[model samples]
Target: MPLSEIKIDDEVFVSEGTVGVGAVRQVTPRELTIYIEGYGDIAIGPDHIASAHDGKVVVKPETLPGAIQAHLEHVHDGEYRRPSDT
Candidate 1:
C-alpha cells in the first residue's frame, strides 16, 4: 500500500509483538508516526510497510528495530517537531 493513502487515526500493526498496534498520530515526508497506547510514539518508514487493508497498516516485523532506531536518531538530531511546537 502507498504511504500517501494513510490517514490520521489509522491503525498500524506488525507481524509480531505488542509494538505492532497503534493509532496514526502524524505523517511526514520522511516517516509516519503512530501513537501506541502506553508505549508512546513510534515512527516507521512507508518502505517498511508490507500492506494496508481494513484501515490498518502492516509493517515488516524484522524492520521494526531499525525503524525505531531511526526514529530515535531523528529525534536526537532535532528533526522531530512536536505538536506543541507547531
Candidate 2:
C-alpha cells in the first residue's frame, strides 16, 4: 500500500522477531514514523513493515493513559502462553 494509505493504530510486522503495532505520529514518502505505545517514537522504513490489518477488528489501540496498563496486562498474561516463533 502507499504510505498515504497507512494510519495510526495500525499493527505492522517490521521483520521477523520484530512485530509491534504502531501509533502513527508522522509520515513521509520513505518512512512512517510512529510512536509505538510502549517503545516511543521511531522511524521505520516503509518497505520494512507489513501492514497487519485486514479491515477487521482483531485488535484496537488503547488511549495514552491505558497504554501502560494494557502492556502490563499483556506481559502478565503472556507468562501462560507459549512463546511465538519468529
Candidate 3:
C-alpha cells in the first residue's frame, strides 16, 4: 500500500529499522509524522516505512547477533511484498 493509505494507530516498521506502534499525528507529501509510545513524536520521510498487518511482517529472528546482519544483507534480493498497481 502507498504510505498515503496508512492511518493513525498503525504499527509500522520505520526506516530507522525499529518496529513500533505509532499513532499518526500528521501526513504530508514529504513526511509521515507519528507519535510512538516511547519515542515521542517523530517525523519520518514518507519513503522510510513499511506497514505491518496484525504481526504478519516477516523479519528473520534476531536471537543470534549475525542473524539481523545476514537478513539485512539479503533484504533487497527480492520484493517481500509488492504493492498492487492500484
TM-score, each model? 0.60, 0.43, 0.42
List model 3 lDDT by residue over 11-65, tens digit each. 5443335544445677676766766444466576534454435532222224223
Superposition error at 30 for model 1 (Å) = 2.8
lDDT of 3 at 1: 35
- Tell me, by TM-score, which candidate is best: 1
Better of 1 and 3 by TM-score: 1
The TM-score of predicted model 3 comes to 0.42
RMSD for each of the candidates? 10.8, 9.8, 12.5
Question: Which residue runs of candidate 3 sit more than 4 Å off their true CA positions?
Answer: 13-20, 52-86
> Which is the better candidate, 1 or 2, if ranked by lDDT?
1
- On the 0 to 100 scale, the lDDT of residue 8 in model 1 is 79
Query: How would the candidate models be sorted by lDDT, starting from the highest?
Result: 1, 2, 3
Write down the lDDT of every candidate, Cα atoms only: 0.66, 0.49, 0.49
Which portions of model 2 miss their true places by more than 4 Å?
8-20, 52-86
Best by lDDT: 1
- lDDT tens digits by residue: candidate 2, 1-86: 46766665555433334444445677687776666545577565644454434421112233224654355245334335678998
Using TM-score, rank the candidates from best to worst. 1, 2, 3
